[model samples]
Target chain A: MLRNTPIKRKLTVIILLISTAVLLITCAAFFAYDLFTFRQSMVAHLSTLAEMTASTSTAALAFDNPKDAQETLSALKAEQHIVAACLYDKDGKFFAAYPANSPTNNFPTAPEPAGLRFEGSYLVAFQPAMQSGGLQGTLYLKSDMGALYERIRLYSLIVLLVMLGSFIVAYLLSSLLQSQISQPLLQLAETAKAVSERQDYSVRAAKLGRDEFGLLTDAFNNMLEQIHNRDLALQEAQQKLRQHADDLEKRVAERTARLSETIAELEAFSYSISHDMRAPLRAMQGYSDYVMENYGEKIGPEGQQYLQRINRAGMRLDTLIQDILSYSRAARAQMDLHPVDLEKLLDDIIQQYPGFQPPQVEITIEKPLGSVIAHEASLTQVISNLLGNAIKFVQPGQTPRIKIRAEPRGDDLRLWFEDNGIGIASKDLNRIFAIFERVHAERTYEGTGIGLSIVRKAIERMGGQVGVESELGKGSKFWIQIKKS
Target chain B: MAVLGNILNPSKEASNRRFTHRLRACLAGFIFLLLAINAPAQISREYQLKAVFLYNFAQFTEWPPDAFADPQAPLVIGVLGRDPFGAYLDEAVRGEKINGRPLIVQRYSGIQDVQNTHILFISDSESKHLLPILASLQGRSILTVSDMEDFVPRGGMVRFLTTNNKIQLKINVNAVKAARLSISSKILRSAEIFPPAAK
Candidate 1:
């Protein structure tokens, strides 16, 4: 985050310089304090000598005997490193002084400590001798302090020089150390910048030492390694996802092609049954009709009965052919499912059966014949076929009562086509709907036994199930359950 | 003082000429005597010349009245500590004297016995005692000398140094202040003044 800044270098350098300066300043201050105290003490010493001399020699100066005063003054002058001695009375009168060769009372005088500039110069101190003879005199004495100042000043100068020299040395040494530290840090910063801006993890930080900078470089290299690994993982994951999508697309394409082939084969089988079987059935019926019509006048009643058998056989053959056609059409029809009104469908079926007038026809259709997912034409055929079978199989002297009902059963529609008719025998009920099978003699019922079989095939093609429940001489109910896909 | 007067009396031109002629003859005679006493000047010639000059300096000097506590006391030329000249200086000062005092040699390890020493020769190794020795002999008739760089600058009486690879001496005028001893101007002229070299 701080790639563009030289914050590390700045912080390192600033800390080094500040600490070095603080140490140097502290040492210098201590040395200076020592030097100032030594100077102060030296000045105090000189002033003390001056005061002592002034006090001791006040009495000797007051005596006023030139010879005794001169002798006393000479003794004072004998002090080592004394330049000249002067006896001053309490009244500030000069009685005598050593080195009488000079102009009397005209010797050079300094503030207190004399000859501080030159080494080994004299210091003059006055001592006043208080006599018991009521004669107050001053005795002057001189003491040299020039050597003391010289030694102190020399010592202080040496300390000052050493302090300055050490400070410079320390500053230079610290600066060198800071460079050693900061140079690598600066290089590391450059490497980090290059890594981020150029996205080049190959550039590694330069390792400078076995210190903290080297450790930081190791950490940086590790972080780059992790980033590189994650990048590779993401790319691999993306590639895998692409491969999965491609496999799914290919499978869907293959399944759709196989479904198209199955639909074509079903259409071809339906077409062949419709055209080929209908022609042969038509020829059979036509030949039978011609024989019965021409031979009826020439033959007697016995011959006429035989001719009638031929005609009935032909008619049965024709019903079989028609049932086959119906089955083929249901199987091959283009399925278009929509919302179907079963009430409207049943009313139309009843009107189509006007010629086969039974005593009465009672049709009850439940309200809300619900809409469903189905082909409209196929569903219409399903309702019409079941209703026609119910009308045709009515019992003698009994009006047909047909009820059409629909209700939801799970995710499908359960439709019921129930009627009261000559029901099937219990043993033959399972086999009654098979092709070419008759439950009774040919004269008893007029059907090819193909109607229920066709209905089953048609309802089954529409993705529905069909079943019947009945008892002999009682009634039968048929149910069709079609699932909503 | 008399040798300085003879050398610097420029107004006595004819006498000065005669003096120079006689000095040349004396120089020849001294050379002759030096040969008779020892060998001719060869290597270590400076050592030989310095020994002869040291003997001359002792003879020309005059000590104070109380310098010798004993009347028959030797005019001791004490060689304190190491003496680099070996037997050459001993041979040169065999019978030298100043003001009728015989030249005697004394060797001392401490400054306590330095009181009566008229001429004190300090070696380089005994530099630490030079100042104290100077102080002890204050107001006495002692001439101090050493062999070191600028010894007179460090408050010695006379310093012996090597200039141009030749042994030479330096004298400090301020060192003679308390002693009240006047050095011959001829000697002063011959030796280099130490104050200028010190500065």
Candidate 2:
């Protein structure tokens, strides 16, 4: 039982030990006092007996009456403890004796000198039989001392009984009182355990008494209250955080939809205006060409030169309108991505484009390009524009040397287009992908400046990135990053 | 004195007309009595000791200055009537003295002849004469002694008895006082005394 309830056991043991010790000390002292006085009283009795025996036997010994001396000594037999008595004449010889059992064989042949002492279990007293101005003889009395031992035995038994009784009472009282301490302690432990397991800090321990356990219970309840309050506060804060995040996400989605609608409307205006402007421009160009061809001789040299300029100006205006339409279409379009065979695509592009055939300008695939996820049309437009720019911007006497390569970067592919051409300056490099952004003059580049801008928008719509790295007087390397299948 | 000397020694062959004849007859009776006794050797040894004790008492006791006729006079120890001590008492007191005076033993037939006696031993044979003997020694400095029962109560100075195989002494101080005898405390110390107030 003590294994689980050590406090109760300890209290009982402590009480028992204390009571036993007190009982032992008290009983020991009582026994000591009783024994001390018992022995002292025994000595006193023996002394009195010796004195009386000497007084009565004095006359008998002085008279040399052996029978009288023997009778006087025989009187001692009436006393229970007395075992033997004797009288000696003044010469210290054995005069007369009265042994308990007759014949007196155990008596010493000669009398011992006068004294009192203990021998074995007997107390021997030798007193002088004295009279007025005379010492007649010595009287010897031997008394048994077994009575003192019996008294001690009796006292020991009583002490044992007292010890046993007190020990039992202490045990009972200790056991009854120990519950006052152990009950509340057990309740507190169980409460603490339950609170931790369930993470519910509302449980409180029971108070058993107006003592330390009560104080502990109060403190425990206070701590649980604080924890319960803190728990509720933390839960409220978390809920608020979650609600704020959802509200912010909803607002961001609404704003994103509105901005996309506005961008589509603006793109519609630019596309419709470009398409309407295309008709007048085409008509102007065709009529100019007809005038230049049909009435060359009827008009003079100056008139013919003016007709040629007008035809050229009309053709340039048509090109600018076509480039603006493509750029506008690349930005304001839905995206469709697929896994396209880039090697086959590049082969088809080379076949479709006359500028990509070897000799005049060369393009090589440094490594086989893996299939990647891209919008087919946008990927084709982006690659085609980069190849065209590469062939167009070259040194005056040099053939365009362009290289195509694809390499893996994490989960995406970096498709590189390197060219031997005049590189842009560092200050204008970041702006090269902007709408209608150009660094070279129009007449020098012989193309509209919208190519790189269209390449950036098309790649961006396909969820890819476009960038160019160059140093003047060297070459340019342009990369488009698209996700791998 | 001559009768006591004969009583002290059987070989002295005392010339008592009646005593010599009784002595011869008593010698035969004594031999028969010795033969009849259960322990003659021990009884005779004990009586011989009592005889010596009587002589010692006479030696130790003091008497009045004029109890003897002169400084050279003998200290007399008288045995009255039948001499139960036989010749032992005389043999014990022979060649002994008390206070520069020679010792003598006397035999008396009656209380009238107990005069000038320092110690009078009343034998058991004359138990009938104990009263008159005590009366005659009453005012004299004479020590009256006996071996009879209740002798001390009857105003005798000393008495002898045996019990537990040892001789014992009894005394009456009143008798000693009436006789004006001065008994030594050492002698009285070993004697059973009566009339306890006169100790």
Candidate 3:
């Protein structure tokens, strides 16, 4: 029943229970001893009374005087506990009785052997009256056990009182002393509760003594100290991480700005260099034509052939420079996209160049080619370069067959340029679109390497993708995809 | 004139007197025979009781050291006159001891004949000489007993009195004390004291 009570109450209850048990046992033992001894002393007392009455009555019995014996027996009246007494002659005849006029039936008809015994609630004694070392008569006495019962009642009261007093004292003492242990534990509990509730580890329990509770408090404080320190260290680490992230972001932004400025300056320098070199080349071409026409007879055939070689080299260099300029322009141009008819663009391109005439090359524009969203100028340059490469890379003396078509693909339009040409190897396919990378030898193909590079850059700037499908010694298929209008 | 005439006829008168005397003697003998049949049993019972009383006195009374010749001497109960108890007193004290002393019955012809006696029952035959007998045995520690009237008043220690067919005791405490013999209170509680208290 006491389990789970506060420590103080539990201690008090335990002490009270132990003391009550001990007191009850001790009182019970004492009560039993008192009852036993009281019975014994009662017997002794009755025997003594019987012996006195018997001794005094002996002379009366011997002298044959009933009155004297009666008087002797009457002395028992002074002892209130003795209820009745009588005397018998040596012949065992009833002689005299106490209270002189008491009924004969009150006395035994005959005397029993001399001894003391308890009969029900009475103590009875039969003592021999001796005279001259002869058995003169017997003396009989009966006493009530009222005194014994009275003593028992008194002892029970005393035992009960003692037990009550002892229990109260035990309770009081335990209540006072239990706090010595419970106080320290309660303080530690409060400290722990505070730590959890606030998520703060700076609080400590007060040490009340140099005991186990004190040691527990010390350990608790030490744990709190470690937790507090770790919390601070974690916060410091998180703050340092945030600062490093901010610095990295700032450095990346600064580097990106500087790189973009350097790229603009390099693009401007290349554009001006290409533009200035073109003026000089144009002047050189005019003067060479003038020399050929005016001094035709005086110069002769060898000088004229050398002038023609110089003129051809100058034209190739000019084409190479113009391809480089076109590549650079494709890389840096701003695109404005709108829908353009693929069939119309293909027809215009075929008519613009005599190289695309029917006797020279077969150009078939698939009718109803889908229109797409693209930068028109970049799309024209990409298609023109693809058609030029198709015609230039064909087998010797074979008619170039070019098939141009467009198809709708999801949200975009795909344009295909199929040509019968000397195809590229699989290993060199990936590097085909790089600037100045010519797969065929200059003497055999007679072309600059930047045309495919310009085509790829112009398509990427217009937000489209371009790829090729070709096998060696067979035709190649080049396709580009752009959003459909 | 009639008396002078009877004197002339004397023979006849003497014969008449002889007849009357014989008749009286026969009647007396018959009465005595009847008394003899009844009195002896009563007297024997009385003395039997007195003999037991004598034995009892020895138990209840304590004598000085000089009362015995030695620690082992027998307590002698002496009869100084006609021994009324006959063998009854002997029977009462047979195989009995008082404080480790054996008890014995003795008969004395005179006061001088009483030697080493703790108790002496002076019979009615010595009633005439009781005063002198008690006086002569004054300094001695003997318990002197008798059934005579005024025995305790005359310096006898104890007396047996018969009243209403029951025997009772009267003790002279003064005489008992003077003899240096102490009677137990048990005996005193049941006895009449001499020199009765004044009302």
Q: What is the DockQ (computed on Cα atoms) for candidate 2? A: 0.08
List the candidate numbers ranked by lDDT, top first.
3, 2, 1
Question: What fraction of the true Cα-Cα contacts (under 8 Å, chains A to B) does candidate 2 also have?
Answer: 0.03
For model 1, residues B1-199, the per-residue Cα lDDT tens digits are 0011011111122225568556655654675676653322332354554554455556444566677787667777777777656677888767654455576777777778776777887765576666776677677778777665546777777776554444445788777554666565434544678576543
Candidate with the greatest lDDT versus the true structure:
3
User: What is the Å distance of residue B109 in model 2 from its true position?
Assistant: 18
TM-score to native of every candidate shown: 0.34, 0.53, 0.57
Candidate 2: stretches off by over 4 Å:
A1-247, A264-354, A360-381, A399-420, A446-468, A482-485, B1-199
RMSD of each: 24.3, 10.6, 15.0
Q: Assess each model's interface with DockQ, reporting 2 decimals per model.
A: 0.01, 0.08, 0.21
Q: Looking at model 3 chain A, which ten-residue stretch has the lowest summed lDDT?
A: A58-67
- Model 2 earns a TM-score of 0.53
Tens-place lDDT per residue, model 1, A235-286, is 8999999999999889888988888778657656655765576677577667
Q: Which prediction has more favorable DockQ, 1 or 3? A: 3
Residues A239-273 of candidate 3 have per-residue lDDT tens digits of: 99999999999999999899988878887788788
Cα displacement (angstroms), candidate 1, residue A363, comes to 4.7
